[model samples]
Target: MSKNIIITGTSRGIGFELVQLFAKADYNVLALSRNSKPIEALELKNVIALSFDLSKKDDYKKVESFIGSNWKQVDVLIHNAGTLLNKPFVETSMEDFEHVYKTNVFGVTELTRIAIPFMQRTSHVVTISSMGGVQGSMKFPGLAAYSSSKGAVITLTELLAEEYKETGPSFNVLALGAVQTEMLEEAFPGYQAPTTALEMAQYIFDFSLNGNKYYNGKILQVSSSTP
Candidate 1:
């Protein structure tokens, strides 16, 4: 049987491109995003686009039901839904930090817990992080909330990998560099990234499929640019 994959943040950017790559490869893909219209519009074969909000507990039920009904086993779970906060440290509020963590950190944990039951030892969990989240990486002034949340998930991924080492599913995190996506454009206007979303997504597609063979609980720095 073809591998069953679940990818979040699929409305656009890397997640959007990843879904198409998997679909073209004849893999079964479940694309999750708050705005599923773009993927639904495409009507790609071997793919199901669902409206999913990572922060909403109710939305997770949609995922559980789908997996329970159709795909009893999941091969890959990619956490790509993240929110960005461009405000300065001084301007950032508690609510701001909570909101970012909701999707980036908490949502990842919750979804992984839910997916574990359906994943075998061969399944792979790929979490998308940011270059800014890596310790000693170049620090940006206005991304305290966003960067910090990304950092949290890195540790979370590590802990999960260790805890499940003796289990079936393997977990890993990728600290990525700037990719020219709408999120980056919104956060930093006109700052052209050396990489495009599709390019990065292709790299992730390959990694998710085979990275588990070599590494688990590893943080791979996938960056060519600093900012």
Candidate 2:
């Protein structure tokens, strides 16, 4: 039987490309996003599309119920969906921070919580973090909120790995550098990134498939020196 994988933020960017990679490899790809059109357009039989606002607590039941009813085992769960609020700390409002955290942190937490029941013993749960979240990295002035949110997930993933060690599943986080995506463009307008969305997607795909063999409760940094 083919493995089953769940990926969030699948409407575009790294998430979208991941859907393609997994689906092409014959994995049952359950793709979730707030909007469904982009994924639906792929028209792949192995791909299942789900729609819900990740930031909202109420929307989670749709995902939980769907997976609960249909799949007994999930081989992988990738938390690739996130948001950014690029503004100076002084100007960043509480709403902006909350908005970013809702999806970047809380959403990932809740989704992973609900997904654990269905995960197989060897399942890999992965979170896509940011380079800005890494300590000793050069800090940007306008990314206080976004970086903090990513940093929170990095820590959370580590804690989860330790807590779940007795269990069979593995948990890991990837602290990524700048990628060529709309999110990156939006966060740093006109800045060129060496890594493309598809490139990052490929890396994530390989990691999800086999990373657990070598890593668990670790944060791997992926980036070029130039950023």
Candidate 3:
């Protein structure tokens, strides 16, 4: 049987590309996003579009429900939903910070928490991170909220990786660099992005399907220069 996969933020960009690529590979894809509109170009037999707001605390329960009602085991879980708030810390309001954390950190963590029960030993969990998560760039003065949330995401991935050394499933984070997506456009309008969404999605699909034991707990960075 084909592997079952769940991917969040499938409305557009990298997440959207991931949904298309996985479905094309015959994987049972549960594409989750706030918008439920189907991608006409990506119509596939094994793909299901689920509408849910990741920022809402109750959405995790919906995820669990969908899993229970559909599949017994989720072969892969991809936490790819994220947002970018490009503003200085002082100018960023409390609401903006909370919203960013709610979607990137809290929502992702809670979804993973609920997903663990359905994951098998051979299952894989992939979280999409950013280069900003690994390094602090003062040159990009207005991204504190977004960058800090991603940093927390990477730390969470590491903590989970170490904690699940025995019976836990494989966990990995992909630190995608400068992906050419709507998110990047929103972050830096009129600036050219180096990476394409479709290419990055294909790379991520290949990485997840490699079935290598050594890949577990690895932080794989995908960039224009990465070979």
Clash count per candidate: 1, 0, 0
Taking every candidate in turn, the Cα RMSD to the unseen true structure, in Å, is 0.7, 1.0, 2.3
TM-score of each: 0.98, 0.97, 0.93
Better of 1 and 3 by TM-score: 1
Tens digits of per-residue lDDT, candidate 1, 19-105, equal 999999999999999999999999999899999898899999999999999999999999999999899898898999899999999
Q: Best lDDT goes to which candidate?
A: 1
lDDT of 3: 0.82
Question: Candidate 3: misplaced stretches above 4 Å?
Answer: 40-42, 136-139, 225-227
CA displacement after TM-score superposition, residue 133 of candidate 2 (Å)? 0.5
Per-residue C-alpha lDDT of model 2 across residues 1-227, encoded as one tens digit per residue: 89999999999999999999999999998899998899999899889998878888888888888887888788999999988888878899999999999999999999999899888769999999998998887678899999999999999988999989988589999999989998998888999989889999999999998999999999999988534
lDDT of 3 by residue, 1-227 (tens): 98999998899988899888887778998888888685434677888887878887677777899899999789888888898899877999999999999999998888888889998888888888887776542336688888888878888888888888788688888887887888888887877776788988888787776633677777776665421
Candidate 2 runs further than 4 Å off: none
Error of 1 at 21 (Å): 0.4
Computed on alpha carbons, the lDDT of every model, listed in order, comes to 0.94, 0.91, 0.82
Better of 2 and 3 by TM-score: 2
Stretches of candidate 1 off by over 4 Å are: none
